[model samples]
Target: MHKPNQTKQATARGRGAGYNPDIRFDRVSRASFDDGWDMVEDLPVLRTQVREESAKTIISTNRSPDLSFDQSINPYRGCEHGCIYCFARPSHAFLGLSPGLDFETQLTVKPNAAMLLEKALRNPRYTPKTIAIGTNTDPYQPIEKTREIMREILGVLSDFNHPLAIVTKGTLIGRDIDLLAPMAAKGLLRVGISVTTLDPEVSRKLEPRVPNPAARLRVIRALSDAGIPVRVMISPVIPALTDHEVEAIVAAAKDAGAVAASSILLRLPREVAPLFRDWLATHYPDRAARIMNRVRELHGGKDYDPTFGKRMTGQGVWAELQHQRFKQASARYGLDRRLPPLRTDLFAVPPQAGDQMALF
Candidate 1:
């Protein structure tokens, strides 16, 4: 693990975090101080570093009750979409990296994901269920354009006739409509496009590397037009900032042909809390206090509450109000209908090149 020097605090271009936070598990810590030499201007440009990860297994099963899917596949670790409010940021600390800038700039790719997934699905004892992708990190992030690891994984699932769903903020998913449309026609694929805010300026500052809100809507339209079911996810609705756009976002997604809509309140867990706070201070200092105050109110007067049921949708007056607003907007736009369940009975492992031929 190569640890980068984090002694300087300067805003990196096209990055959300202005500085790296200390890795929580490290015994030793470092801090920045002025040496009276005015060295901040000498810092180098932050570039994304990619590392290949050879994973032993591809499918990860989680027992969290609040989650809709028990199994998920993350094609990559750490995300390039530097959304400061990401809950997945803390996961990077386990890789011996800071959850701040490092979480976005340093990425780990899983090249063997497709191979491992095929092996998992071929097991005789394996039972078919909906396997979700992009639950923790965006599978179709900027790197996916070239890596195409996600495309390979989808290929394996398609060959097996496995049911799968995807949640993403990237427009690259549109490129795979050929693969997705066929699966969707067989009732094996659905997509959730997360749109945090409709405001382009706010979106740029919040999710520095993500596709603009309008572009995301275009992706939803493209996917829907291909006969693929699309769900618009209004995730991490930032209070006092983008929270007011919930109705508008749902309406826009519905107009773009999304069949369903969902929303999650802003979550600031572990290292993400401070990083998001720093972002607020830098970008919207005037309303930073008000925004954080509302977040605390939503989370039982704390930065965050990890309680499963209360985590996704907060537990306060404002949280309830936000939920009500989303429900009303969804109903108004006819985006409240649940997508039909994907077929698990259709799951069948295709014969490999060397497999024994069946004879009657």
Candidate 2:
């Protein structure tokens, strides 16, 4: 249901736009009403959606050494979190949809995720390894509250004693503490909350639907108090944007009981380039050009470069300085340390074919 903006949620253009499958517009705020008197406004445009049922799911596997784990699962395609700079936005283009606003509004849900995962695990040749969740789109992204796909998937992994990791910007993970807390006690689970900025105003503009920074910090404390390991991620350290808050954020998260921390540089890839540029122009018109110029300088004279070796952390004097600052700040707060590893040695095959008890 697309609710027309009342007062708080206005579009960037100060006018409502006609929907075109190919284009997306930045939103703006305005004071009063303007006249179009078109009946089309009353028409319920069935918001576009992407859906999936079941198949031998070929989840993406990558051998990136810098990451935490080798395997992961995505229960949904396209996230609803309207973060303007999300690097995952471009992925929607493969489904013949605009990566702009559609990347958030047009969502694809895999309803059979848990069943498929159980089948995959039951195969005799299947090996048990820690499989991460929320890597691409947040597993606990708003829709999961209703869809229950992530919850179901977690249930299956629990039954099999599989190790798991999750990274999210949402507060919903707190709802599953019953499952997560036990996993942590068994050395089978860990979660990292992404706290982008300390300012609520900055967080509202940057992450849109994501929980506010204070709320996310509360989640960190809640998880820690429950005995579930919590890590804080200061992600996409946009140089002049939120970069200065790194030390402050780490200090706060550490006080809230986060055990370790990590971060990444802003990633602008594929369609995210134009979207991010539009966001910068809308939110920080005065500093937009300067920010892009710095990014280009770091990329060896481009707005962005996709080279593997330096994609996550760009190479240049500026990049080096940012990396050094992060290292220093993390060490200062004692957040550079690592947490206990998730134990994969406890994994086991779940149930027997004739086991009615497996229904539990």
The Cα local distance difference test for each model comes to 0.92, 0.78
RMSD to truth, every model: 2.4, 6.1
True lDDT of residue 225, candidate 1:
97
TM-score of every model versus the real structure: 0.97, 0.86
Flag clash pairs in model 1.
Answer: none
Instruction: Report how far off residue 274 is in candidate 1 (Å).
Output: 0.5
Question: Can you write out model 1's per-residue Cα lDDT over 304-323, one digit (the tens) per residue?
Answer: 99998999999989998999
Predicted structure 1: lDDT: 0.92
How many backbone clashes are present in model 1? 0
